[model samples]
Target chain A: ELVLTADMLVEGVHVPRHVAPADFAYKALAVNVSDLVAKGADPTLYLLTLCLPKHPEPGWLEAFTSGLSNAQADFGCSLAGGDTVSAEGPVCLSITAAGTLPAGKMIHRFSANPDDKVFVTGTIGDAAAGLALIRKEVSAHPLSGEGAMREFLLSRYFRPHPPVAAIELLRQYASAAMDISDGLVLDFTRLCAASGCGGIIEADRVPLSPAVSALLEGDAFSLEAALTGGDDYEVLFTAAPGVADAIRSAAESRGLSLHCIGSIVREPGITVVGRDGAPMQISRPGYDHF
Target chain B: ELVLTADMLVEGVHVPRHVAPADFAYKALAVNVSDLVAKGADPTLYLLTLCLPKHPEPGWLEAFTSGLSNAQADFGCSLAGGDTVSAEGPVCLSITAAGTLPAGKMIHRFSANPDDKVFVTGTIGDAAAGLALIRKEVSAHPLSGEGAMREFLLSRYFRPHPPVAAIELLRQYASAAMDISDGLVLDFTRLCAASGCGGIIEADRVPLSPAVSALLEGDAFSLEAALTGGDDYEVLFTAAPGVADAIRSAAESRGLSLHCIGSIVREPGITVVGRDGAPMQISRPGYDHF
Candidate 1:
């Protein structure tokens, strides 16, 4: 089946000013591949369009393509072809990625049933914490006293490992699926909206990496960002209770950790239960560019 | 076979400052669809990425999407999906279009052989002449004494009709093919390079629209620009002598006019035969963004 998606990263907007050229290139491809992973589609080919500066620095294109090639190898996709043009504006990259799934097997964000269990792959909020660290919004904290945890959070924001090998299990088990991009609350809310269902998620049960746990040990702001700061690129999916064992086995076979954080409900909106078992007040559910 | 291509139009680079937003949007999709036509690919789907200003003018998104929808209908393709982001830089649009051709029947830029008859579809240099007129490069040419010719050239620059219906015939008969987006001379040279061949063309035989002919009757600079100015988006193909009848039939059936302008040669470069049947010297063959 034809499943196509386009994603763009604009210089100074999506990427940081001090990002390495190689990292920029890798992000360009990785982000698009992440979309395919969410759909449980086998990555096939991609078309990259670079709107670059008039006079690029020496070796910039080489580094950029090197990163792209590295990601292509990493994700099992080929660079079919691309267009490069000199933009008198800031550098921007646009990629159109194509992938294929078995007929009638693509999981949709709107297919979740009220009784389905909601699960998210990998740790959440590490990227958000990492971004805070990079921005220097939060310096040293007693919670993240270890240097290793700090480095882990920082790296998580820069690169993510999407669970590509679990596509079979996901396709078989997931009643609904989507990638976490614009924050957990927002994206999950979107998922609920699409399925015409609602969910109740336990905040404490949301998967958190040691790095993120340490970084935001006591900061409510950090907690909020973790829930609403997006860019995680982790797979958020739902499955029926009968297939829980099979889903766990599939994820373990790929050496991945999947966490069950909530369940779809008959309610019309999402309700986040805090550690106290009461609905937590949310100021904003997600990020919006417009 | 999957065929994909990308094209970008950066504000102030691809479009003139005086162009309307609607025209800008139309040109963005038209240029990319043109590439698919040259490849004899059946239009299927396209993804659009718009790097727009943070605060767009009222009705900008509607106008832009309207433009995209119009082109989707105009080119017989679907807007599968896309990404949108705000860039502080100038407005830039990147479109990745995907099409399919019969298995193992797609034409290549490097497939032309020696003695292949080289032909270009439609009249050449009209877009270039139109652009010149828009830029006031040629204000009051005696040949284009009427306003109709001026309007024709301007319209040609703003919108191009890629011969999408000619794909079946092209796949059956064409050995090599490419679109003329970056001037006839330069793209043709690239085609020859890709095929490890050369070509010779009588300049007077290069089909020219009445508007272009009238606009460049007395100005060699204008004439040269018309020949090498690019943005013409016409398919250039090479076919064997036996396929000439088929080529004519293909064009007539599609209501398109194909012009035989040159022939592939064993020699390794291009030669432009003037009206006097002598090789003419060229200074700049085409525009290079780099």
Candidate 2:
């Protein structure tokens, strides 16, 4: 069987105007490859559609292709074919990735059962904090002024490491899965919605990186904002409680960590319990493009 | 197995700024489907990546999506998924289409032989002429003044009919194939290049719509432009002589036309034979984006 998906990145929207060309290309491929990971499909080939401005910077194409080569090497996919056209708009990149899976083994978002435990790969809110740091929207305290934590968050925002290695494990162990391109709260809810179930997320269990934790300790950012921030590119999934150890071991072997945030429920709505063990209201779940 | 391809449409490049929103959407989907048709694969799914300008017209999305729905029904492909983003520049659309072919049965452009005969589906230069007419670049006499002929040319430009019905016939007979998107002459030459052979094209045998013929007779459009005009969306293929009759009969049964315009040759370069049976020089073969 085959899995297909496409994601487009427009300058000033998905990538910052001042971002490095190579980083822009990396993010373009990363976002799409992340989708393949959710399906438990091995990333194989991709086509790139590039819309360029007239007389772009001399090194833009070279650097961009270099970045694409790097990601191609990282994700183990080849560049198949694509189209390039000149436009008067900001640079736009549309990458279509193809993944192959064994018959009857492709994972989906709608397979989660009511009693499945919700699990998330890697740290969730780091990319969200990374984005906020890049945009200067949060000045959260001495942490922003002191450690290399700011650079760590910025790196997450610019160059995400898509977890393609976890695909087979997820397909083998998980009941439902999807990549966290949108915020974790929204994407997890989307998975629940697809499976016709609900979730109760313990907000404290939502994993955060050391950088994010430091920022929170300095009162520079809030846990609520992290939960709703987008562009994480992590895999959010649910599986039976029996597979927890194997999921953790697989992620550990890859030099990454996994977290169990909460559990799937029989209800039709999500309840996000605060760190203080009380249910909290979320005004907005995640990003929406119109 | 799955076959994938992506093409981009940018304002003032692929489409005119004044074209209907629905028409633009149709063209975006049509171009990608054409590639799938050339591969002799059944287009089963497509992903649309749209970069829209800020503050687009109120009804634009509705009309655009309606056009997509119509084309989706016409092509028999469902919208699998996509991404939408706001751009600060011209509207850009990137569509990635997926087609499935039996294992080891997919057609290729590099498989033609020197003894094969080249054929093209439908009319070749009508869309190119349509583009010129739409841009007010051609003002050729009574033909341009005629109502039905003018609209015929314009329709070819805005809405292309991909040859989805003829895939089986082509795959069974043709050794190599590709869609004539960049113009018959250029795309045919590309096929020859890939197959490591040459071509001898008889100018008079080239297919043309009634509007194009009338334009040529009235000195409204040049035959050179007709030969090298792009955006035809016709399938160009090379088949051995033994199956020619079967191919022709199949096309007839489907209410479409086919023309044997040229033959692959042992030489290493293409020879464009004029109506007088002599070689002719092509100043500019087709469109090229740099």
Candidate 3:
């Protein structure tokens, strides 16, 4: 079966105008690959439609193509064809990716049962924190001012490495799946709604990187920000409780970290429990372009 | 076999800012369908990526979607899925169309033999004349103000009906084929370069609508403009001389008009001959976005 997904990135709306051309190109392809990965499909090819305001300066197109080539190699996909045209506004890029998996083997978003265990691959909220740092909405004092932690956070924001290796594990165990592009809580809520169920998130169990942990420990950032921030690009999925140990062992063998963050319930909405075992308040769900 | 093609259109660059939303939407899809038709494939599905500067006014989205829906019905293609986002500048649209044809039966642009005869579907230069009218670069006196001729020219510009019915004729008879988004001489030159041959076009044999003929008679437009103007959206193809009669009969049976305008030659470049049988000088080949 063929799986198709498209994503659009606009300057100033999705990324800052001063962003490195290579970084922008890499992320543009990576995000579409992330969607295919969530569907348990291997990306085959893609079409790139690029609209630029004017002729690029020397080295701009070279750097952009290099980044795109690197992404194609990393994701095991090739450029099939595309269109490039001049625009009268900011640069806009649209990539449509095609992938394939065995027939009837796709993981759907509405297949989770009420008792399914919710799982997420890798740490979340690091990219959101990285974006906040880039926007100067948060202080970098928690990272002791420009060390490995700061670099790690910034890399997460600029070049997201979505877990492409999780395809086999997901096809084997996940009953429902989606990628976390928007905030974890918001996207998870959507999954639950589609499945006609609710969920309970144990906030303490949500994974965090050392950088985000440091920010939280120093009271420089709140846990709510991590839960509500977008651009995670990690796989959020659900599976039967019986497959938890098997899934963990498989992830371990593959050098992937899997976390059991929550579970689906029969209720009609989501509830997030803090470490003290009380309901936590969420200011907003996720990113909304409109 | 699956056939894929993509195109991008930007506001203010491709069309005027005040262009009708419905026309814009219809043409966006039609242009992509034209590519499929040129390849002798039946369009099956498409993915759209739209970026807008702001939330549209109430009737804007409705009109745009209605036009897109109508085009889908006409072209026998459905929307698979897409992404819509906010842009910081002009509205940009990218459509990736997927089509299907029998394996090994697709027409190519690089297979024209030296003796093959070149043919084009429908009349040329009407869209260019319409664009000239829109830009106020040409007087409407030739069209005699707001009459059917005036409306016809504008319709050709805004709603290009690229010879969709010519697919069968091309697949059956064409040695080389491509759709003419650019002008005839320029696109034919590209085809010749790819096929490693040359072509000679008889200017008098080139087809034209009554409106463009009147413009030429009044000195408001030139035959050179018709030969070099872009946005014709007609199919340009080559076939062996032996199949010319068969191709014409087949096209006639299908109610599609095809005119033999030129012939491929052993030389390395193109030549245009006027009615007096003397070579004519061309100022420029076609439109170049960059």
Candidate with the greatest DockQ versus the true structure: 3
The window of 10 residues in a row where model 2 chain B has the poorest summed lDDT is B139-148
Candidate 2, A131-153: lDDT as tens digits: 88777888746484454777788
lDDT of prediction 3: 0.89
Residue A3 C-alpha lDDT in model 1: 75
The deviation in Å at residue B271 for candidate 1 is 0.9
Indicate the docking level reached by candidate 3. high
Residue B188 error, candidate 1, Å: 0.6
Candidate 3 lDDT at A132 equals 89
lDDT of 3 by residue, A99-149 (tens): 899999998898888889999998989989899888988888977655788
Q: What are the chain A TM-scores for all the models, listed individually?
A: 0.95, 0.96, 0.98
Give me the candidate number with maximum TM-score.
Answer: 3
Calculate DockQ per candidate and list them. Answer: 0.84, 0.76, 0.85
- Show where candidate 3 strays beyond 4 Å: B144-146
- Candidate 1, CAPRI quality class derived from DockQ: high
After superposition, candidate 1 runs with Cα above 4 Å error: A141-146, A218-221, B140-145, B218-221
Stretch of 10 with least lDDT, candidate 3 chain A: A142-151
Residue range A70-166, candidate 1, lDDT tens digits? 8888889998887888966668889988889998888889999998999998888888887777788877464545587777777677766677776
Task: Tell me the interface RMSD of every candidate, in Å.
Answer: 1.0, 1.1, 0.9
What is residue B188's positional error in candidate 2, in angstroms? 2.3
User: Candidate 2: misplaced stretches above 4 Å?
Assistant: A139-141, A144-147, A242-246, A249-256, A281-283, B242-246
Candidate 1, B1-290: lDDT as tens digits? 87888887888788886466777877888888778877878889888898888898888878777867777788899887888898786788888888888788777899889999999888889888877777777774655456787778887888777777777778888999998988988988999989999998778888998877766675623656767887888888899978888788878878877888889998889987877788877778887888
